[model samples]
Target: MPNSANLGHKKKVFDLFAQKVLVVVGKGGTGRTTVARVLAELGTKTGRRVAVIAGTSGTHFLAKEDPLLSFSSLEPGQVLISYLYEHGLGQLGKRLSSTGLASIISTAIPGIADLLVLAKIKQMERSDAADLIIFDAPASGHFLRLIATPKGLADIAAAGPLRKQSREVLEMLDDPTRLGVAFVTIAEETPVKESIETMKQLKKSSGIVPCALFINSVLPSIPGNEKVQDLSFLESTSPYYQAAKYMRTRSQSQKHYEAMAAKAFGLKPIEVPLVPTVELSEDDITYLADIVELQIRSKK
Candidate 1:
């Protein structure tokens, strides 16, 4: 049901290796997390030291205890949270004061020390190691604020170790070779519009362009032919014929909507089909990986 006019146009969604850091953004319930996980897996498959991190308080939900999961059958170092209060504070204290003095203060005021440590952890995560770091950032509206945190903290600290750390983060954010943002959305009106707006804001605020737009749950356009007509007719004999017809119609409508949304946003949309279930098994993930690999191969 996609616009027949836009059927064969190719989009680049998987050619992301050129980017050092990639942030995926989208409206809620648009499969942003799924896409982020896939990209992280792909990065790891290529033997890159990849780190996946959630950008908000919701990190606990996405990654419970072991924040990282291996996808390529190879076990790697665990992914650590970028906001560990105690450990971060310890590192900051070591940088700020002598080991003996910092240790004494840390013991005396553990609560305050932990709070300071947490901030430093976030700063280090934003600017440190790993060939590819994937950030499952907050939804579009709040993602911008998260990205702006370094600048905010920099201004607050002014002239201390915190300021220097924040500056490093800001520098990483501004470097094109160090960062890229991905916008994910469904083939729906509101999400698509929000994605466009998010892109505009991202460019204005960060001066970094999004490398791709992922159109999650895209309905493929099946050409009207004898086969489709036969399938359409076969539904007439069933009690649920009406439901079948509705599904077919809905699919077509969704396709057209996605096409228009992609055109309006001026982004080459990468289509990911809708699956029947919410919980994707390893086989399902493999199927998706194959699809993505095909898309990447086609681009080449």
Candidate 2:
């Protein structure tokens, strides 16, 4: 139901939520967290139960007053305790997780911490605790490792409980109808190139391509740069003309990279306008969410 002629050419993100898990990823500093937060806000506003999880502190980004959202940070010890408490081992969970041995054990398991992150997310979705889980997964390199963990375990553990658990996590991660990646990138040489390669590695590893590509912080084309340029006398002397020309040049560069990404990844990148500010409030986040929401809403 997404409306943009550009977005209409690809899968609407709202449709992807029906599968329940969205992993937002990109190179560091590409606003992956920003994208995850906006997606959570928009999903909550649209009446779905939403959870936002990150490896860092939850209080760092989420507003507690919002009842529609549940936020959590990924911590192995806490997850182990929570898992134990759920299965009627509350006293044992608390005592063991409180000790240093729990940390040491988690470290010993190659990807236990990250796999628990996925396990917790899928459990929340399956239990109907949330209609959608937006995961602010680590940047590209680590994300690939996280998804590959279960498979690696499956390859090693031929049989028994660990094998069974690994298979379950593997199925959940590869369930494209539900779990998918959203690649966020800025319009620049390195990020654009990295995005292309990341998408390739993701598909190669999990057999799932990106569900969406958000070209964040795009500068708009300066209005009537051509007309202004036509005034030959103003071209040299006018600051207005120079600024317009600069903007036009930059906008074109963005367009070129955008095109390259589309051709390489076969996704129509959603061009989110640059919000020129150092700091953002809840209202600003909502405003940005509105921009994204416009792309995925039903045409009806």
Return the top candidate by TM-score.
2
- Tens-digit per-residue lDDT, 1-300, candidate 2: 111234235443444465688988888788877888888888888788888888544436745477789887875456754654665666665656444554664566656556666676767767877888888876536546667444665653355444666666778777887788788998888999988987887688767778888887778655585576586767566887788778778777777787778677787676667777877678878888887777656342
> What TM-scores do the predictions have?
0.68, 0.81
lDDT scores for all predictions?
Answer: 0.57, 0.71
lDDT of model number 1: 0.57
In terms of lDDT, which candidate is strongest? Answer: 2
Model 1 alpha-carbon miss at residue 287, Å: 1.0
- Model 1 agreement with the true structure over 111-189: per-residue lDDT tens digits: 2232343233344345656667666665535336446444443554465454565566567666767677777888667
Which 10 residues in a row give candidate 1 its minimum summed lDDT?
A: 72-81
- Which stretches of candidate 2 lie above 4 Å from their native place? 1-16, 62-64, 75-109, 148-150, 156-161, 231-237, 298-300
Candidate 1 off by > 4 Å: 1-14, 56-129, 146-160, 220-244
How far is 40's C-alpha from truth in model 2 (Å)? Answer: 1.3
State in Å the error of residue 201, model 2: 1.3
Error of 1 at 79 (Å): 15
Q: After superposition, how far is residue 61 of candidate 1 from its true place, in Å?
A: 8.1
